[model samples]
Target: MKIAVLGTGGGARAHIAKLAALGHEVHVGTRDPQATLARTAPDMMGNAPFGQWLADHPGVALHPFGDAAARGELVINGIDGRNAVAALSAVADRLAGKTLIDYAVPYRYDPDLEHPWPTPWGVMPAMEPVDTDSLGEQIQRALPATAVVKSFVTQEQTTVVDPASVAGGDHTMFVAGDDADAKRQTTDLLTAYGWRDVLDLGPLVCARGMEMYAHLHSAIGFGLGQQFGGHFGIKVMR
Candidate 1:
């Protein structure tokens, strides 16, 4: 499988590492490959520089967005939710007839806050109103010919790659898309990452619930004193 993962953040790095470990030909897509490699400082969350990770994983190739998307059999949208559409637009034509696993959530961070703060608990980001439409739906609409599957949005980076890191491995992750084949492919990828309780919530519209759940997810993280520390996940008991 030739997989292209976009972004240089922790989420993208995790996906790249795990997918590469699975023996897929992985290409990392970024806006500026040279700038990304030249970055010496950690990200806003203080995670280690992506350059270090890139150095460690020599098997992964880095390319600009268009080139990476053109070369991939499967494309993972790990870019920031706010800029996902703009970033992917560069490769929109190449995405036709391919499975696009979208992990981008329309999460609006407060510019005033230096880091994501647990405040006004159980509230969704103001910018993305769940009642309207989700980021997944928007992206799907943007690329009508692409099979966009919404997934991995509710998880932390660690748990997205290794679901077993959470207790009992009994928690649930979601898949939502109009295409059955795309959902199945996304599910298989999740399973390969040790996710045992993947639930298909049906159609891309259901992503509304998934995206809205960010509030509760954030509340749980705040209660635990850790925002997605791989120790907790939403579990469906039934």
Candidate 2:
């Protein structure tokens, strides 16, 4: 499978490495490939520099957004939540008739961000389109021809790639999309990553719940004194 992953941060690197390792031809897309490779410092999230990570993974190719999207059989939106639509919009024509796996949460922390350390998990981060719609839905709206599957947004990076490493793979991840074939394809990809419990929440509108779950996810991380560690995941006990 030829996969194009967007973004230059940790999430993009993780996806590129894993998908390439899984024998998929992976290409990473960024606004500017040269600028991305010129990055010398670690990212805001404390992940290694993009240049460094790219050097380690020679099998993955880097290209401009449209070029990558044109070349991919499947596209993964690993870009920041706020920039997803704008970034993908540049490649909208190429993305038509392809499965787009959305893994971004539209939440931004204020500059004066301060967590209450080891107690009640402070206030939730400010998110966009809160009560009315979700980022996933917005992405779908932006690319109506593309099959947008909202997934992999609620877990840590390690958990997204290797679910078995945490909780014995008992936790559940979700897929919400209007297209049944797209959802099935996304499920197969998730299963390849060791995700055992994939629940299709039905229709893209349900993505609002998945996006909002980030609040509870943050609360649990704060309560556990480990911000977004791989030790915890959401499980449906029937």
Q: How far off is residue 47 in model 1, in Å? A: 2.1
Write model 2 residue lDDT over 119-235, tens digit each, in one string. 343434577877789999999989989999999988876678889887789999999999999999999999999998999999999889988887778778777788544358889
**Candidate 2 local lDDT, residue 159:** 77
Model 1 CA lDDT for position 226: 66
Which residue pairs collide, candidate 2? none
lDDT of every model, 2 decimals = 0.84, 0.86
User: What is candidate 1's local distance difference test score?
Assistant: 0.84
Against the true structure, what is every candidate's RMSD?
3.1, 2.6
lDDT of 1 by residue, 1-238 (tens): 9999988788888899899898999988999989988889988657788888788998899999988998899999989889998888767998889999998768776534444444643323554646789888888888999999999988886788888877857789989999999999999999889989999999999988887776677677778886443358888877
lDDT of 1 at 179: 99
- Relative to the unseen true structure, what is the C-alpha lDDT of residue 11 in candidate 2, on a scale of 0 to 100? 75
Per-candidate TM vs. native?
Answer: 0.91, 0.93
Error of 1 at 187 (Å): 0.8
Best by TM-score: 2
